[model samples]
Target: MAKVKLKKLTKKFKEVLAVGNISLDIEDGEFLTLVGPSGCGKSTTLRLIAGLENPTQGDIYIDGQKVNDLPPQKRNVSMVFQSYALFPHMSVESNLAFGLKIKKKSAREKQEKIRWAIDLLGLSGFEKRLPKELSGGERQRVALGRALVLEPKVLLLDEPLSNLDAKLRLRMRTELKRLHKKIKTTIIYVTHDQAEAMTLSDRLAVMRDGKILQVGTPEEIYQKPKDVFCAGFIGSPPMNFISGEKVPQVKDKNIMVGIRPEHLSVSLTKIAQAIPGKTSVTETLGSDNYLYVDISDQLISVRLKPDERIPEDKSVWLFPHQGKLHLFDKTTGKRI
Candidate 1:
């Protein structure tokens, strides 16, 4: 395992800047994920690190050694792409052993490594099956095994779970986390799915247009985002951003307050210690309720308690948890 560091790394495809000047330090043995929407340069950066694409500028280091001139084969990294990139005619064992064979390992060593890899990935029975004969999850496992057998210093996964169905994706996610824990290799994963990033990563770097917007644990990025874009990006139903001024009530002006869905409290009337609002609409989600309220000339969402239900087709009062509110610089879109 190795610490991967990118110092002001940049990649440009002629006129368009694929990756802006970016810098990040992925700790050794850390399951670090790079997450963002499409065109955010997550994949570009990953490619640069893998030496699949050369950076337009900047330096890349693996364990303190500059590897800017090294090719992908010399980088000591394995890439697991979205496509799974499996050989159609090769059986699982052959597929896993192909790389070692090319590197000219001894026959006994190849057999030993293949056996160990198959067992490690629970692919013992499927070693003789070709990619076409295997299920999606099994094929994915084969791809993982192939990468793992290489014993790469770092593992680069680019949206490896995107091909799986929803149920399988969820299952594979748990399996991927388990694999990471057991292998203890430095992993840099790139994905658009925030939930996957949150669940699998020890630390996640949120990217936008080739720049890292924020880097933190899932809780930190969710509960305390550095800006509005991050607050809006990493959640389901996301955090609500209403264009409201600093409604000075008691202390400092809580200007451009951000309230997560779960941090809001709904009631028949506004509480004495919270901001007042008129209910716009309420969505019932079986165990929980979502209340949309017009407060301070903006609409915000509130999460209702388990046993509570919103009175239908009528305006209700909402009390926002002031302590949970996040204040931001409206002009700069930065946390205040």
Candidate 2:
């Protein structure tokens, strides 16, 4: 295991700043994920750590040693790309042995490492299979095995499961968590998928426009977002934003009230501090229903039980759960 640290790391593509000056510390054996929308620099940050991209400024340290000038091979870090990058003509065993062969390891050492990785990744039975013959998940496992056989101090993954189907992605997520537990290698993963970040990471850093907006555990970032963008971006179905003027109890005129769909309930009868609106649409997803209501000039979504049905175009009252209310400064977009 190794601790990875970045100090004021920055990357530029001529006139474009792909990664702004940012510093982060990844503890030994921890799984840290960099998550954001496309063009947000999460992938660039991971590349910098892997020595695939040179930093425009600042320094990178792996296990307390400065590696700014080290090449990727000398950095002792392994990376798994989105494409898997397996050789089509090579068998799984050969692909996993390629790196060790390049390093000219003893034949016994190479065999031992290959066997360990294949067994760990559940690829033992498919060692003789070519990449073309493997399923998507199996190919992904081969890619992972290829990286694991290298036995690097740090493992960097760049959206390694993005191409898989929904069910396969879910299964891979579980496998990855299990793999991390078994190996305990320090990891830095980059993905735009918030669900994957939340589920797999020990902690996650949310970035935008080449800068990190927030870094925290999934629950911290979810329940107590620091700003408007985070509050709106972290949750599923997104958070509902209402102008301060629309909420009479908001004392500050320059503030906006944010409430999650799950925190708002629709009521058939009148309730205190409830806003009246007409149901615009109702979406049923088996376990729960989402009710979109038009209030004033804005539309807001409220979560309801599957059995609770609000007819479209029918009037209803929406009430925010007092404990779950989030208030943000409208101008700065910062939470109050």
Candidate 3:
């Protein structure tokens, strides 16, 4: 495993700044994830660390050694791309052995490495199968195996599970976590999915535009978001925002109050100190119902129990749970 560090990293295209001055440290044997929307520079940051893209400014260090000028092959890092990037014509065994072959490992050493990777990735019987013969999940394992055989100090995964279906993606997430525990390899995973980041990472670095918004554990980022952007971006249904005027308790005139969907309760009967609204829609998931209510002219969502149902166009009252409100300055969008 390796400790990777980025110091004031910045990357720029001709007239566009892809990555702003950002510094981050990934501990050895830690599973860290970078998450954000498209064009947010999360992938660009990963590419810079992988030596796939050169930084216009700043420095990169791997295990305390400056590697900003080193080629990717010499960086002791392995990257699994979003597409898996497996060789279509090569068998699983051949693909796993390719990197070792380039390094000129002895026959016995090569065989041992291949065996380890195959067994570790649970590709025992599929060694002879070509990429086309394997399922998406299996092919992904092979792609991972190829990287594992190289024994890289740091492993970088760029949304490797994005191509799989929902069930397969969930299965792969568990498998990836298991693999990490077994090998104890340092991993830097990049994804646009907040759910993936929440589940897979020991720590998450949330990015937007060309800068990092915040870095913390999933729980920290969720429960105590530093800004409105983070609070809005990290949740499933997302936190509901109401202007200060709509919520009179908020004293700051230039502030917005945010209440999570799960933090608001709905009542069919009129209730004192409750916000009145008309139910616009209700979506039933397996375990819960999401109610979209139109209050004044703004729409706010509330999470309710599966049994709770309010007919569309029916009047309802919304009561925010005390102490669960999040306040942000409207001008800066910073937490207040």
Q: How close is every model to the real structure, measured as TM-score?
A: 0.93, 0.97, 0.97
Give me candidate 3's TM-score against the actual structure.
Answer: 0.97
Window of ten residues with lowest summed lDDT in model 2: 244-253
Instruction: Give lDDT: candidate 1, residue 222.
Output: 91
Q: Write the per-residue lDDT of candidate 2 for residues 1-336, one digit (tens) a residue.
A: 899999999999999999999999999999999999999998889889888899999999999999999999999999999777899999999999997888868999999999999889988789899999999999999999888888999999999999899999999999999999999999999899999999999999999899988999999999999999888888888899998877656756799899999998898777768888888998888787899999987899999876787889988888888788899999999988
Error of 3 at 153 (Å): 1.1
- Regions more than 4 Å wrong, model 3: none
Per-residue accuracy of model 3 over 159-226 as CA lDDT, tens digit each = 99999999999999999999999999999999999998999999999999889999999999999899
CA RMSD of each candidate after superposition: 2.2, 1.3, 1.2
* C-alpha lDDT score of every prediction, in listed order: 0.85, 0.91, 0.92
Candidate 3 lDDT (Cα, 0 to 1): 0.92
Give the CA lDDT, 0 to 100, for residue 83 in model 1.
82
Per-residue lDDT tens digits for candidate 1, residues 1-336, read 999999999999999888999989999999999999999888889899999999899999999999999999999999999887888989988899988877767899889989998888788889888899988998998898888888999999999989989999999999999988898999999999999999999999999988999999999999899999999999876887654443333344444667789977666764565566677787887777887777756777778787766765455555556577777877788988
